[model samples]
Target: MENVTGLVEGEETTAGEAEFYDRLRPLVASYCRTPRIERVAVIGNEPLGSSEERAAMVDSADLVFRVNGFRVDELGSERAVGRRAEVVVFNRGVRPTPWFFAGYPERLYLMIEPGRLLWENPKLPEFWPQDLGIVTMPNREVVLPLGKALGADPRAGGQWATTGTVMLWIATRLFPDAHIDAAGFSFVDAPGQTSWNHAYGDPSAVGVEHRIDLESVLVRRWIDSGRIAYHR
Candidate 1:
């Protein structure tokens, strides 16, 4: 609705973004655990928001947190921009591109896309057992407390030490009756960087391909194992 001018190219044009948003809307409704998303966070080099973006979010997302460092002026404007959103965009990129921000929860779903982030970072496995990989990572890194000192992307792997694990992790502090669903190469068990690249299209769309069957595997394990908290 509001004319989105001056957006970075490649997923930045108004028509382009509108199409992306159009694709994203029903996709979430179709794929997510619920018609409404409870709450969500997406941390990346860039930030995208629209009034309908709020409506597009599955019904559960009462609040949406966007964490990005690149756009300072635009950051503050997010609140005003997405009038329909109970949204907040944090300006965390004062420094160079490092890892994901740690000011949120302890454990989360770090969206490691295979496009932008991986492209900029030729170095793979900067950190070990990274929050999640752009796609498949060496099986060795998938340990508990999720290892930190490994060979994954330093930015991604550093999260385990800083707060938890990931170049970026998006999770809910107040989780509810929810289920987990993620997509992409890792979700389907496709291996290698090439497969990851082909399957996921773009690395910046971390939150996109992430699917979950975690209600049984991850959530049940985390809560029942006394590993994580499940609250209202």
Candidate 2:
């Protein structure tokens, strides 16, 4: 992400690129137990700058966005991220963007319980996942309790379930008493090709953790059948 975020001198490598092979190696091993993942695409939030710059980013994402074609300027951000990444890597919990900005301490302080603090904060209500956890606020976008400056813009994904959503703030829009009743799973990791690190979300919570496990399998059949693929 240092490279992607332009944090490094010149351009080195995208953070997503560095983590790609290692992330899938374990998942494939636990599932296929042999090499299957060859090519990978590490993507980030849509670029925001000059028209040419944005166009270039869109062009490069052709392989990365198999489900979404490069949209024309006539339209706008459609469900934000286009799709839940076939594979995503989050930066874990520690947010670095706040420190860079001025007056950050006042942005994220929590007085009540973390949950209470979240709901009470005027800006943070956007981060709450809703529709039975079908959606959430985009990274860097949730209005922090103390931090009024949002680090990232809220994003949405198009899914069959959300047929008529009104594009409300999802990340900070948690239910006032939304704690679950069931016990959490004991698995070491989540099961999916998608993965993330702190940059994508809080590591302690589920956002940035690598979305794969021993049972996690990237089906080669999906590729063969022309489903769930990059570089079509």
Candidate 3:
């Protein structure tokens, strides 16, 4: 991987993207309520150690952020990542499953590609029963650096950061004052072991849009800088 150096820290955004983001800021702030959160737990789908301990730690946070469709069963099993998710992150095409709506998150952060609009999707429900707020993903400004670092246009989609990594990035941007703790994300797999990527999906058919190597590179950079606390 090439050195990110000055790029990741110096994010440059076009005026249009900046204006759209500025309009969205108030919405996010209203939904998030407090600008300076104390702590947050961003849960990933990777297998974790001591599920009970991890769950306890996660639940103790001021807010819990879960990615994709991760769920917890009985609070002590491997399936139990966290009991509650205050913020749920999902990609553009992937809507939240029934379980996600039932969990009742404070906000649903939809990560969209550059030219795509969520309202245009036919998959959106006619009415959201939970009365949840919505926040667009990638936070363009925050993701700009990562995209530049990886030589990929996040808005164009295809071969970008994994949903887990995106959620991690969102947490850092949305809750700037919060100390973030992440569980269940092991960024890389050994040779020939790449098949076992997520906890629920069929390994061999896990799809290629998620660029784990690029995501891993950015993740390692964050870990090294103490930006996020990772629990493998």
To one decimal, what is the Cα RMSD in angstroms of model 1 from the true structure? 18.0
Whichever of 1 and 3 has more lDDT, that candidate is: 3
TM-score, one value per model: 0.24, 0.19, 0.70
Q: In model 2, where do residues sit more than 4 Å from their true spots? A: 1-57, 60-195, 198-202, 205-220
Give me the runs in candidate 3 sitting further than 4 Å from their true place.
1-36, 73-80, 95-98, 105-111, 114-133, 138-145, 154-157, 189-197, 201-204
Clashing pairs in 3: 114-155
Cα lDDT, all candidates = 0.27, 0.23, 0.59
Candidate 1, residues 26-77: lDDT per residue as tens digits? 4333333435754432222222343333323322343333332222112334
Error of 1 at 201 (Å): 23
Comparing 1 and 3 on TM-score, the stronger one: 3
Which regions of candidate 1 are displaced past 4 Å? 1-37, 41-60, 70-232
lDDT of 3: 0.59
Tens-place lDDT per residue, model 3, 1-232, is 2112211354334575456556654554554434655777888877555556677778777777777756554533553566666677776555444456664655555554432421235344555554665556544554555566666665565445667776776666555556778877766433223554555543443445556667677766666666677766
What TM-score quantifies how close candidate 3 is to the native fold? 0.70
Model 2 over residues 96-190: C-alpha lDDT tens digits? 33222222222212111122222323232343224211122222322221121112112221111110010111101211111111001112123
